[model samples]
Target: GAGVSQSPSNKVTEKGKDVELRCDPISGHTALYWYRQRLGQGLEFLIYFQGNSAPDKSGLPSDRFSAERTGESVSTLTIQRTQQEDSAVYLCASSPHGSLTDTQYFGPGTRLTVL
Candidate 1:
């Protein structure tokens, strides 16, 4: 009955470097999400994955940001050519199902710092 979890709780990287953040959602959950929170800003939706359906990636900021998930398990968010503007808290969440009204359980987030 573990909650969602993210790895490397803190990441420090230089500009132009690439970083991969990992997430493990609750067992049996069929929906997973990735979000970003910038300084003094609200959470920004990055991507969403549900069951075997195609992922919703409309929220991704640019081509430099990408994510992947296999089945209903672990997910990874890769940021290529990191930028200073990319410094923020990357959050992961999961719900029982991919529904708009479902409650999402959040992880502690991986703080990414770009220098």
Candidate 2:
């Protein structure tokens, strides 16, 4: 993908169902990240994968929220046993992270609405 791309931009589901969101980052980029934004709150970093290093999973709200990136390109986020509190926009970002304060490019995000 030229820029970060996310699929199924909007999702509505009954609570308790599982969901998976996909992300395709820009080519040649080396870092990928997932974030969750609830209502009016600022973006919360969920997981970050840089190169082959151990993924930084410091921000996932719970074990139910998990993400994976294959190599330096595509990634996916899965939310299990979804709850109403999980309703929000799931965003993915990637950047050329060799330098400090790299500019992260964002995707439009998948809006998950759990009823």
Each candidate: what lDDT?
0.97, 0.91
Predicted candidate 1 versus true structure: per-residue lDDT over 1-115, tens digit per residue: 7999999899999999999999999999999999999999999999999999999999999999999998899999999999999999999999999787899999999999999
How many clashes in each structure?
0, 0
User: Candidate 1: what lDDT?
Assistant: 0.97
lDDT by residue (tens digit), candidate 2, 30-105: 9988999999999998999999999999999999988888888789999999999999999998898735888999
TM-score of each: 0.97, 0.94
Structure candidate 2, residue pairs in collision: none
* Root mean square deviation (Cα) for candidate 1: 0.7
In terms of TM-score, the best-performing candidate is: 1
Residue 40, candidate 2: Cα error in Å is 1.2
Model 2 residue 2 CA deviation (Å) reads 1.9
Model 2 residue runs over 4 Å out of place are none
- Clashing pairs for model 1 are none
